[model samples]
Structures are given as structure tokens and as C-alpha cells.
Target: MAIMAGPGDPVLAETAAERIRELMDGGFVVDADGQHAPVHADDLAVISPHVEQASAIAARLADVPGVLIGTANHMHGLEREAVVVIHPLVGYREAPACATGLGRLCVALSRHRAYATVIVDADADLVLAHAQREAPRDARLATQRHVLAALLALG
Candidate 1:
């Protein structure tokens, strides 16, 4: 599943990434090619809407036992057990300026086939609202919402 963390806060993104690493037992791997390659238990992947953020996260996780970081573009068409998306709301409001970026974020969230997605952000409602507006008639978005609801309900 694809998880989102944001309002474009770097601190939150970093913190969320760290927490996820802990939950995964410090196991995460980068799909490098987004080929849906096999990942071990210790493998962890971080996806970000911005290259700078992704790179920063990668650098911060450099010493982690088992973690890989990259932008959503790098993991296109790939599937993993879990994916953490940081600062997904970066350009959510500025549609024109971030049209490509927003599209990338959506593609990253939708294309990546994960069992669970952990979205970390202060304003999840805003994120959802923007997403609904962006893709009101998209079936994929509907499915994603359903799955996310189910996951939340399970907890």
C-alpha cells in the first residue's frame, strides 16, 4: 500500500519515515527499477513527491540497517509490501504549477501495489479533499479509498 505524509513538512516526513522504519524492523529496500522485485523483511522503501525530499530521506536513511529511498517516479509500476509517501500535499493546491508533480504523486500511490499504506500528515482531510477533487470519477481512486477505509477499520 502507498502511504502519504505531509502538508510538505520535511520534519514530519523524516519522522514518519523513521517510525515506519522502526515498525518494519529497519527492513526496507529500494526497487531501483520499479520492477516489482523481491524484497526481504528488512527492506524498506520511502517515496516522496519531490526529488529533493526523496534524496534527503535517502541520505538520512543511509546508515539504517535496511532502507531504500527514492522518488515515486523511480518506483513506477512496482509493488511492495509497504511504501511511505512524504509531503504528498506539497503542490496539491497549486494544480497548474505542480500538475506533473501531482500526477506523479497519484501515479506513485496508485501504481505501487502495497499490502499496507501508512499516510502520515497533520491534515489528512485536506489531502483527501484535494484528491477527491483531482480525480472525482477515477475508479482507481475509489478503490484506493475503499482499501484505505478497510485498513483503518481493521485497526
Candidate 2:
């Protein structure tokens, strides 16, 4: 079962780990290389309120240089903000939402590029992991550089 913390307290890493455990139902199912494991969960419905709160916080955090994931306030800030929007997985898509579990977040932060990606949940581990994914905050870090480059090249 997923451990619940106090209303305002930050979720401990262990709590996140525990939640991850609960999502997978105990045993971690990893692939051949053991890079990313499978996670089971669906939609932002589980934590819509939390996603809203995080989005609010992200709105406040906007203009500062950070990306908030999983909130209603889609894109924030001016000056060519390249936010990586990861939609919730309908049915085992390539990239899934963090609402379901941290495994997909792990995959994205470990693999995909995102500067200020918004998650559909208030999972701090996913946020921290994404932050750690791109330490220097490359707004264009996890973006389609090729497409962007092509567009820019036309200009």
C-alpha cells in the first residue's frame, strides 16, 4: 500500500519508493537490460487536486527558471519556453504519466529531455528526478532539436 504523509509535509524519498513499490504490487518487473521497470497506474484522476496545487506552485515558480509538470496551467513564462508536455498513457504508450508511478518518470528523466516538464501528479521524486536529469536546466534539453533546428534554419 502507498504510504500517506501529512497534508503539507514533503514526501520522503522512502515514501516515494514505497509508493513505487505499491504501484507495481511489490516485485519490480525489469526489462532485459534492467534500465527501466514496468509500472501500473492510470490517468491523473487519482491526484487531480494535487496536480492543480503543483500547477499553482509552478505558476508561482514560473519566470524563475523551472518547469512544473502535471498541472492545469499548461505553459508558463515568456521568452520561448520549450516545455515538454508528457500526456498520460491511455494504454501502455511509449511515455506514461507520473500519476501512475515513478517508473515512467524514471524513464523520462533518465532518457527523454525536459526542462520544465509538468506531471499530472504531485510526485516529488519524479520532479526531483527530472530536475536531476537536466541539472543545468537546458530549456531545450529534452526537445526536438532537429525539428527546432530545421525551423530555425529556415528563418
Candidate 3:
């Protein structure tokens, strides 16, 4: 997908942008500010927190559908366009960010009527069958909030 890693970080943004542009047959040529987008992903830092920037990139990136992924070393806010932020632990002390875990993530994407399911991928299907079971909505969300609180405490 097309990308513009937030401000100050240009490396990742440039590489991701270049790859996406190549995949897009070179249609991606503009940045959030209407300038020529970077040529590689390593040219990124933290993408601007402006929705316009996101919209610009999303427009080009949407060519690849069903691709739900994002990355962060230590996420501090709602990472736009990401259904999941892979942090060792998420922290939300002042706000109830993970009061709904994946549900909240779905809600943030405007899809709230969701079911909470945790899946474990491995070679043994039978062993992971039960491991992939769904959790009660409220309970799962509570667990997420609790985990976030714990992370905040540890930090």
C-alpha cells in the first residue's frame, strides 16, 4: 500500500511508497502536501497526523485489498489505517483505548458490530483449533484494557 510515514521519519515511508508505486504501475506520484512523494520507505519517520496525508496515501494504497497490517516500536496514539498495532504491550492510562481490544480497533475503523477472536497459527491444527476460539465480547475488551493498564504501570 502507498505510505507516508509520519513527520521526521522519511526512510520507511519512501521505501514503502516506492514499492507500492511499483505495484501500482507507477501511478503514485504525490505526497500529502501535493509534492512528489519520496522514492523509498527509509525516507520516513512518523507520518503527519493529518487525515489528509492518510487519505492521500490510502487512495493509492487501496489497490491492495484485505491487507491489514501496521507496525510500531511503541505506539502512543491511534495508529490510522491499522486494524492492529504490534507492540509488546499497549498503554492507555488516561484514556480507555483498549477497553475493546480488537473490537475497539474495528470500531475505530467504523465497524463496531464485531466478534472478538484470538487466533494462534502453527503446524498443529487440532491444538490451535481451540486456541483460535472466540472470547466473550465484554470480557475480551476488559482484558485488553487491563493489559494496557499493566503496560502503563510497568512503563
Best by TM-score: 1
What's the candidate order when arranged by decreasing TM-score? 1, 3, 2
Q: Please give the CA lDDT of all the candidate structures.
A: 0.55, 0.31, 0.31
Which lDDT tens digits does candidate 1 get at residues 55-77?
A: 67766676664654666778776
- Tens digits of lDDT, candidate 2, 32-53: 6866543332211111123543
On a 0 to 100 scale, what is the lDDT of residue 20 in model 2? 30
Stretches of candidate 3 above 4 Å error? 1-33, 43-134, 139-155
**Winner on TM-score (1 vs 2):** 1
Candidate 1 segments whose C-alpha is farther than 4 A from its true place: 1-8, 26-42, 90-103, 110-114, 127-155
Model 2 per-residue lDDT at 67:
31
Higher-ranked by lDDT: 1 or 3: 1
Q: Candidate 2: how many backbone clashes? A: 8
Candidate 3 lDDT, 97-151, residue by residue in tens: 3223454333333311121111111222322222234333445445444544443
Model 3 C-alpha lDDT versus the unseen true structure = 0.31
